[model samples]
Target chain A: MKENNSFILGIKHGIPICLGYLSVSFAFGIFAVGSGLSVIEALLISMFNLTSAGQLAAVPIITGGGGIPELALAQLIINLRYSLMSVTLSQKLGKTVSALDRFWIGFGITDEIFAVSTSKNKSVGRKYMFGLILTPYAGWSLGTLLGSVAGNILPDSVSSALGIAIYGMFIAIVLPTVKKHLPTALCVVGAIAIGCAFKYIPMLSRVPDGFVIIIAAVVASMVAALLSPVSDEESEQTDEKEVNTDA
Target chain B: MPSMNFFFHLGVMAGITYLVRMLPLVLVNKKIRNRFLLSFLYYVPYAVLSVMTVPAIFYATSSPWSALAGFVIAMILAFFEKSLLTVAIFSSAAVFVTEFLLPIIQ
Candidate 1:
């Protein structure tokens, strides 16, 4: 009975997240179809990989006929943050979670979900975690289905306009943090500078999109990390502030 | 057609993504003590998102001008710390309106 209550609470907490994902995933679905994927193909990608940025990066590689190593490496670079979130989350798991349960719960560790779960005052249990994941998963998959169908039917002009929606979402994700954090601001500027060089310079323009993204991200992040390594005390304070703001 | 079958690519993407999330949760019972690694991980998302957004964003729409309009709107709203959904929808609207007006203006 107690487990059931937490599960219900989790679903209730997930409603706003579901609504937010619907629009973002819809844009993704249209973008994927515009990039040459069939509607079903777009839907499949969203269903299998419940990541916005990772899926955004993956679609280009997939359609461009990128190799397995390229795909794997891109996924690693794009989703590496999840590994860190999972580590932090593991410490917050309630005693009800068993070894096998950890594997299943691991699948739902998106940035939003992690924030919601961690923001709670108490440790989260397996049932609550599953409940939290279920609603957003459905929202994400359903939104893709709607958007993919819309992409096929919508006129070219409108669909083309929708193409910028994802990038707008990307900007929304990065800019607020950049505004507050100097290292992060420099990281964005550095990455953008590298990105432009690869796009414009004749010799560097020869590099594939996958490798260019990887190189810019890795190099910029490495430089930022080296320049101002965050100590444990500062990291914890930031985490608390993030959770507080999230709540 | 892709060099390999589509399922193969899907498998690789899904497999690698899942493994990265799963390994840490299942194996790591303690807080990560490595500072540089943590900082690098902290900065990765911002760097990756920035690299992907610029240059590419300017080309996302039919007109680079419209894309720029949307990008500017998104950056402004985001600087004020608007919600993700709000920023995304308004930016798309900005693009739609800008694209509509461009042909007439020219």
Candidate 2:
């Protein structure tokens, strides 16, 4: 009965995440197809890899004929922050989550899932984790499937507008926090400045898109860390705010 | 577009992403004590997402102006703490409207 209850609660919590992912992944579906990937390939990509930013970054590299090393490095850099979330979430696991269950649970630890699970007052268990992950996974894959299919049929004017949907989502994720938090606002500003330099400067503009993201992210994050180190207590508050960022 | 090569590349990307998530939860039993590292990780999503959004967003639509309109709408909605879907949809709508009107205005 207890197991069933947590599972239900997990599903309830996950519904919102699932709904949010539907739109974002729908945009991803359209973007991937617009970028020349077959609809099935886009669907397969979403099903196999649930990382939104990671997959978004990967599509360009894949379509551009980037090599294995470049694609690997791009995924690693773009998705590396999940490691931190996974590490943090590991501490919240209950005894019901055995060592083996860690691997399964880890697969579902996107930014939103990690936030949802960790925000719970009780320790997360295997059943609860499974229940929580299932809905969002379905929503993500389904959204992509729908969007990719629609991409082929949607008019160019509409599809072109849809291209900004993902970026709009990103801005939505980053800007709200910027209003409330100083370090985050500064970090975003600094990163955008660096990003602009890479996009416009004659010499630096030659750097590939993959490397530019790496440099901008690493340098800005390192600077923020050095300038405004967040203490453990402070980190907890940030985690609460993270519920809105990734989905 | 080669079937075998596409599958191979897809596997590599998915494999690397899975390993990044899995390795940490499986290996790290204790909380990381490094404050600097933790801070860096905390700020990483912001940095990376911001870098990806800007300049690129400006080019996401048919015209930079339309993209900017979408971006501005997104930022305003986000500033007011609108839901993610609301912001995203409205931003796209803003772009659509801007693109439709740009020709007449020009």
Instruction: After superposing candidate 2 on the true structure, give the runs of residues whose Cα lies further than 4 Å from its correct spot.
Output: A1-5, A244-247
lDDT of 2 by residue, B1-106 (tens): 4388789889999899999999999998788899999899888888988998988998889999998899889989989888778888899999999999999999
Q: Which 10 residues in a row give candidate 2 chain A its minimum summed lDDT?
A: A1-10
Residue A196 C-alpha lDDT in model 1: 94
Summarize candidate 2's per-residue lDDT along A168-245 as a digit string, tens digits: 888887887788879989999998899899889999987777777888898999999999998887767766675755
Model 2: which residue pairs collide? Answer: none
State the lDDT of candidate 1 residue by residue for B15-106, as single tens digits. 98888999999999888878789999888888898998888998888888888899899999988877777888789889899989999999
Separate DockQ for every predicted complex: 0.73, 0.77
Docking class of 2: medium
- Looking at model 1, the pairs that clash are none
Q: Give the runs in model 1 whose Cα sits over 4 Å from its true position.
A: A1-5, A231-247, B1-4
